[model samples]
Target: MSTLVKEDLFENLLESAPANFTEARQTAKDLYLKLGLPAPKEEEYKFTGITKKLEKSLSNFNQAKPLSVEENLIKESVFQGFEGDVLVFSNGKFLQEVSSTIEGLEVSDILSSSAEIGSIAKAEKDAFAALNQASFSGGISIKVPKKTKVEKPILLLSFNGANDGQVITPRFWIEVGDFSEVTFLDQSISMGEEAYFVNKVVEIKGGLNSHINYYRLQNESNQAIEVSNIETDIQSDARFTSVNISLSGDMVRNNLSLNLLGSNSEGNMYGIYLLNGKTHVDNHTNVDHTIPHAESNEMYKGIFDAQSRGVFNGKIFVRQDAQKTNAFQQNNNVLLSDDAIVNTKPQLEIWADDVKCSHGCTVGQLDEEALFYLQARGIGKVQAKGLLLYAFAGEVMEKIEEESFKNHVVGLIQDRLGSKF
Candidate 1:
């Protein structure tokens, strides 16, 4: 599990890559060697033992290869009533034939474009991001015109097919023009029964006075492992909101970072993780208030059943020049079984003299009083538990503006609880 071993493995993987990516791949290889993987001793990764999982998947790295999925599987994965333009990727390669036609947006294949796709997601400090940039086979770039408001949401579907211990890296870049509004539904799902690993990166830039809403749904197979990074930059008077829902995965780690670079910008993040069995999920969020009159808020909730484990870490930073900044963060967890474990941390670092900031975290079981009340009304024990858990998660789900999507999420949560009970 040493850095040299990983370097050699990645080097071998890159050997078959196209000649066009030689320079970028070399840069990533060097960066990976320098930064190495984050060990359990690292403060940021203290609670999550990601190195072990990485090692297990990388041991059979040579067996990793691209997989093609059936059309029926793709059709079954789509939301029933979704009216948005769909963009599909199979094993990190964009499938244009399966994607819907986009009208008001400009979309390009990142690999085919001549434009420079620099490191906008702070790859210098994030080892996984560096690896993704160095090894990503294909990706998409989206641009929204100034003053244009997209009527429909853009659905980005990344599906992983059956593969043996293979690794997939997908990259995405999004740019919102001034005074424009856009919504995106990004999802990751696995159709494979074999063990695999996915490393993905998404970078977003919001123009002045633009509005952006993003939803990330992770529904991988129980045997899959996913590590994802999302970085966003908000300009002056812009607004950005993100909702992350994690329903399934053996090991899942999400890194979300937001930079409020312009004055009067706003950012909000909400998430819910429902885990059972031995699944493990970790969420880390960082929001930076570097300018005056910016606001940021974050709320995350988790429900752990059986021997599942969950981790939440939220950090907000207010710089010396960030006067009049308003920031708030909270994390809550509910454990249904004695074996379940949760680690919650809410942090705030303020250097400004004139700023308002607060954070709080709590871990507990379902309210007995509410459970009794529901049972008294003739509801079954399992039904009562499901209702209470749904209520606990509804606080974050209410933030979803799209009614159909919210209802779909509700159904998924109910199904998960039913199976457990």
Candidate 2:
């Protein structure tokens, strides 16, 4: 109930780590202890009290050990019927490669990485990141060679399961060489019945003149609590696109940050979240234009039903040297029930005189006239509402390039919405 619990948790985690990582891990632990976890009073975490959730869910959690998952579980957890090179991780440890479709892709253990591990997603940015850097094990690093264009998507599936309480920290480091192209589907699914806390971090680096498309899907049980940090650095003349889809979870918070560190680089971000029951979902995004001749666009939309709550905070920063920069951001939400709550804030800060930037947010109910228009054409009320809601969410949903993955997401969306035809 006090700092003793936090200190004990930190010490126990340190004692459990390998001796080889003591120095760096101790540095990270000190950083975490200095800043501590996110509380309700912190402006950045005001809407989501993730620390309490982590403490309550992971206090009595069992010690993490080697875990092996059934092949069928990995098969089902992946995108159903989707064809691609699949990498599976069970309980924060790299399990195996389920399917391999491409060649010349370099894969290594997370512990095998040195300078590349914390290069982009610096642990100094936040306490959760620091904690993950200090305690994670069995993560994996992926490298795509220069001039190699992967023809198919790479599916990375991570599943977490334990007796009752669980604390799983998984890390992913991705590096792409110059003039290369690839697509990745990063997904997480819950495999346990009781409460669990999952802290995940993903770092991505884009080489010059390269193109990268990233998709993240989070589908967890009602008793799951999760926090995910995705950080990306883009080089000169490169293109990066990321789409995050959150379908189900009890308490979920996602931090997506991007830095355009070179000239003529571009970044695009899209997200969709549908929350029901007592679920809570928070999405925080940051885009920084550190150089000239760069552009970034961000858009996120969500629908809240029942007693669910949703929060979105988007920030765009244009530095003094970032001339000729163009940035835009938008956050929109629709509340389906009276008890549903949504908090959205869009911000833009530009120090460059020659830059163009804009940000806005909207929170409102479903369209009444549009619903009536559909119902007047002999369509039932529930079906008409479904049609309208689907149309509202379609703008971002249609961004998926893979047909099979899109279809799988469509099925999950329908299953969650439960609207009649």
lDDT of 2 by residue, 271-294 (tens): 999888989999999999999999
User: Model 1 clash pairs?
Assistant: none
Q: After superposition, how far is residue 106 of candidate 1 from its true place, in Å?
A: 1.4
Candidate 2 has a TM-score of: 0.95
Residue 415's lDDT in candidate 1:
87
The residue-by-residue lDDT of candidate 1 on 28-55, one tens digit each, is: 7678778877866788888888877777
**What are the runs in model 2 whose C-alpha is more than 4 Å off?**
1-5, 61-63, 97-102, 163-165, 418-421
C-alpha TM-scores of all predictions = 0.95, 0.95
Worst 10 residues of 1 by lDDT: 57-66
lDDT of each: 0.84, 0.82
Distance from true location, Cα of 249 in model 2, Å: 1.3
